[model samples]
Target chain A: MALSTHTTTTGFLLPSIHSAPPFFTQQPNPTTQSIASEQWIRLILSYARHRRLFTLRVEDAETAGNDWDEVLRNERINRRVLPSYLSAIIASMAAKNVAAYEPPKQNRSALLYWRLPEEWAEVLHEWAISTGQLNTILTFYDITDPPIESPLTNIPLPLLRKAITILAKTNRAQLIGVADGEGVRFFAGSK
Target chain B: MHRRGVGLAAFDRQEQSKRSFAELSSALSQSQVDHLHSQLSQFRTALAHFASTHRDSIKNDPSFRHAFQQMCSSIGVDPLAGPRKGGWWAEMLGLSDWQYELGVQVVDVCVSTRERNGGLIEMSELLRLVSRLRGVMGGVITEDDVIRSIKTLQPLGAGYQVVDIGGCTMIRSVVKELDEDQTVILAVAQLNGGRIVEDQLIQQKGWTRDRARAALENMLLRDGLCWLDDQDEEFGRSYWVPSAMQWDI
Candidate 1:
């Protein structure tokens, strides 16, 4: 087989290596496995960043119709990354610090760090300043489920909290308590 | 006038002996030297004429170049001995420069793909990659040309070698040697399009499970020559040798 590159239905260009049958398997050789894992990590991060996805679970490989379907499985070759193999890949990614176990306790799933929390901090601050939401008390729910969709919209709570914490260090933000749950007030902190 | 020489003096044992043997020997040597000088000049003129007329053919035409190389060997000439070893005759053709340039490109392709193929590349794959690297203007090259270029690379002692395994030609850029069982594994993998399973080896080669596993594991773990496919459909695990695989890239 040529193992040519293919464009997915979602318009992401898959690298040619993704079409190879053995690419889905967890390699036994450390060197070979490292190369494969490096490729998978790069592919995963880029795809997650493209679709604005932030989570990857072993269950996604077990079931169908998940956001990672395009990558975790190659329907053409009848090959899919087995759950155990994907778990191994996730563990590898976590070891590399490119990803982490989501919920902070489970190993089967990961919180994809498409954008690190530090990067998200800058984006968060820039978003608040540009939208004229500065000096306003914005609740966690309001930022994640904004009326107008935003970079932060649908962002997982823990990741959003981490970004807020990073901003609080720079004195660009302050945490407060609203009537419902919790909130944060933005400050035009000196640059 | 020569009749007196045919007298008894001509048969003298020690008096004359055909006007002294030393003088006759010197006379023969002088004439032989003159004849050899004329022959050497003629050969040089013919060679110079051939070099000027067919230099481009030697450089650009593969078939013509092959024929020319054959003729050189038939005449006991080493074209690739180059100007350093041989005289300026081969240099006049500039064919060694072409050969050396092609060798560089061959090394380029081999080194670039060494990581994926584990320094063992199929001959045809190496040819295709080298051709693509040269681009359209680089002219077309045949497998013969690549083999010849590799010969030019032998002096570098980087251990570039052409190996024949089960009738397939492979270029091995790495210095490593393949053990007997690994050789069989590679040949089988080539037939199956780079995929090999332990069961197949056990059945076809009459190898025991332990022998098969040892060979496959050595290839996968020790050499990094083959990749492990744990999710194989028919078998849970299979070995895929990248060098044996036909990659269009």
Candidate 2:
């Protein structure tokens, strides 16, 4: 087969010889798989951060099919192959501790913040400064709720919980349990 | 006498040894001794088995390698970086829980956003906001976000009436401000404009055809709103036109 070449804006040169058929396939050869998977991981993290995408509905994709061509071009997000191909990438990332998996629920979508733990920690710090809620109780939901940018909203719930747990350990935030007449909710606020 | 002394010494030594043996025997029952020995052996076997099994499973089972993939699929979540702790963690996330038992419901036509974008709030924001807050904070503009975006130009004058028809809530006003009557009639009139139909209005605002028509007629009498000439006694069969318009002020 005739070989081709492409260069990303980052100046990385990729040989396009084998990119014709297998590149589009969900399961590629080992080398191609690794490259594609890494690229996909990097792409999702960077793209999602740029958009600050916290929630994605299936219908949103349908709408975006016309509008957000750049995002829609990424084969990684094809919901048609979602439960299989896309899920595997998430699993791999979780296994490597490179990201978190927040299991999706109805009305709730998975958020993957490419921002690091330290970034999230810094955001929490800034939130403390702005809200003056130091040494106070805040719910897990409160941290992710608006009024400021939070990794919790942009990341999946499972990962967000992990981030909170990490913050608690670092003495960055305090998680308190308060009960009104109903049940208890976990409140995490900066210390 | 010397020979007898030697035999007695030997017997005394033998008795001492026998007492020591008896004490050891009494300390442990037969079953207990057996159980201890067996448990030690079992522990060794279990450790060996666990180590070898984990090693083998890692190599053999692709499912074990990609278990997190399955969890994400079942959970309807996009995956990210974190620890993979299998089924228990999955359950903790409530991935398989009833949060979605009713299934993912997409509002076919999002009304809340439309209300804000269409500037319908200038026409009706205050009245609705006040009515909602009636049981609470005295109709203050306490609602901060999108509700404010849809706020009406003026508060509904005190001369408004709230009517409940067949368990559906409708508001009526004479002096000014679009009340429940105008809103329902507007909804009915707007139905032909691809805004809403009878069932949708009924479902969304809890207005039956009877209630919607009464509200429509009241608006017509006031020369404020209009509806299609096609009339019906039943609320569902009739259509309406709401005169949500601007006057030459």
Candidate 3:
């Protein structure tokens, strides 16, 4: 396949190394591999943030399989990241606390943490106060998929819960658990 | 007649100063010879004191050591002759032997690794390899020290030079000089992870087909930048720059 440059749907330009064939393969040298893995992590995190994608499956993204993710596979270059290489990259990311394995033990899927839980809490708190949603109860779904325009809209529910937990720690927000679902109420001037 | 007389007097003065040491010694009285010996001993003591004080700086700082060598040369001293051959100056500053040893090792490393990197290795990578080769036996070699050693290698016409390619300081052997076109191609290849195709060069650099082909061919055949996939018709011809190639090990 012919190699071509890839850009995200939101127009985030991928680095030129993305089109290079060797980038998809695991570099043999430790120093070169370290640099390559760093670039890969930066690319993956930025692409995930741009698409607002929280979860990534290693099989779908890295290997040649039925459910192939375009971000990890370049058809024109005929280079798909080997599963072994992808695992190495993911292991490095986990070590650096940039990502956490979903289901903890399986290590099949990863939750990409482009922003730490503390930073996400600040984002949600800012949105709540600015949108006049303070002092009112918001379900996990409401904060993640708000009806009105807000920064928290479309945020994954599990990630939203982590953020809410941070706010509860500071007494800036209170979590209310009902039979059906969980909700959080934000307090004013939690800055 | 007056000008000729003055010229003759000036020539006589020049001859007096140029007299042989043996003739001057024969002409001097016993007391004068003793006074001259004391003065010469005093000068030697002062020079030895100066050299001993600045020994560390002379060993580490290149420019300071250069000026010190110049001063030594002006006084008819050979500071680099080693402790055995060179009398006091060599014993005062014992850096010449270390510099010579390091220079030889640098040449060895460059020649041995030339086949792999085509005599072009990044400064940091070269230092790492050289340090590993030395293995705690040799003293630490800094970038400035390496440059100084490479400077010493220049007189031999070995063509060892530190070149700046794509913002990286690379050591290139003078065995093969990369012309402007080959250098440009190498710079472009560096951006693409050491792999470059004829069409990419033409498109990115706005060069005609012939110009790109000629440069690539020169680099491949003459410069030893390996050509990849020459047999594969699908990928066309891609050139791999040995220095730019990120080796796994």
Candidate 4:
């Protein structure tokens, strides 16, 4: 059992199947590394979507006690997994319009929720209709910014921008800019 | 012997660990064994890399098979004849993988050292020759376009050798030549010893048997380069000898 342990966001511990040091490291063979990185990037995006998470803070993993953060940072795997390798995958995805980057500063982490804002906007529409909030005016920040009353609250600002644009296109919502308010507001279209 | 699946890692591992014959042979010098080992290592590495990198394509390519067979022969191992039983060295070299293998379909076309015009036939010359041949007549030709007509001639036991310089190349093949009953067949048989069949003249020319036969016989006789094999009922056959007629096919 050379297996390493990983903890999922839901707090379930599981053995890591892809725990080889090379799995974490960027491949010295550029071609293989690129392919592997693509696979990893896809997997990471899907995982984030499933967990409904955005904006992963690498440094806060110790405090948050999430297993993936710790597992990803393990010295054996991280030795080859350079920031550049991850960045390349992110950039490629962005160029294809498959995913966009929320560039990380010193303490900020990336927010990659594989589903784009347009998709989220659709989900929001369905949720609003089903939950009986259509044809209502709501603060934009109220929907996206969170007290976690709804699952959509956890979505990051980048995704919020996409969602707003999508809603505006269908004449489903109007974004009204207001001065001296805590956040923006939207008026839903049609019943 | 249990045969494990062969892969790059396994091949590399075996080559790295295997002991050379020089180690066991008391009479052989160490330096000789060391040199042989180095070459073997290089060959193994190249083979492993190629096989892994081009696994799918090689499986589909006939030329790749030919090249692999040639490589196996160069390694002093007949792919058909399995290694000697219970030999550690044989096992290390992956002899089992090739054991009980069917012989590779070998087709070679030998071209003469002279017929290639001192070895400088340009692509235009090859294209012109192919264009004259029946199937490719007026057909578009490209460097990558397959020489299909030549491949078909393999069953007739025709093959080709493409010379980069000015000499002729031989194509040894297993294809059947068009019989006299079907249509007229004309082959400019070279006078040299290797039975170099020059170019195939097919289609409308293929229908003109008597003319084709007469043309071949007259050309050979006039050039004094080759003697007709008048007995064989197939296409006009001849034995060409150099220094007599210059066969321009």
The number of the candidate with the highest DockQ is 1
Q: After TM-score superposition, what is the CA distance of residue B87 in candidate 4 from its true location, in Å?
A: 41
The per-model DockQ list reads 0.40, 0.01, 0.01, 0.00
Ranking by TM-score, best first?
A: 1, 3, 4, 2
The superposed Cα distance between candidate 1 and the true structure at residue B194, in angstroms, equals: 0.7
Could you tell me which residue pairs clash in candidate 3?
A28-B248, A29-B248, A29-B249, B159-B174
Model 3 lDDT on a 0 to 1 scale? 0.72
Q: A78 in model 1: Cα distance from truth in Å?
A: 1.9
Q: Name the lDDT value of residue B173 in candidate 3.
A: 72
> Candidate 3: where is the Cα deviation over 4 Å?
A1-10, A62-68, B1-242, B245-249
Candidate 4 Cα outliers beyond 4 Å, as residue runs: A1-17, A56-68, A75-80, A96-98, A103-109, A145-148, A178-191, B1-249
Per residue, candidate 3 scores C-alpha lDDT tens digits across B1-249 of 245335688888667666765576777776688899999899888877888988888766778878998998998876666553345554776446566666788888778666546678767667766787777533477888788888766656788999887677788874667787777887887777678888887898899999998887776655555433332235644666656765422
Native contacts present in each candidate (fraction): 0.66, 0.00, 0.00, 0.00
Two-chain complex of model 2, DockQ on C-alpha atoms against the true structure: 0.01
Model 3 reaches an interface RMSD of 10.7
Expressed between 0 and 1, the share of native interface contacts present in candidate 3 is 0.00
TM-score attained by model 2: 0.31
Candidate 3 vs 4: which has more lDDT: 3
Candidate 1: give the clashing pairs. Answer: none
lDDT of 1 at B83: 47
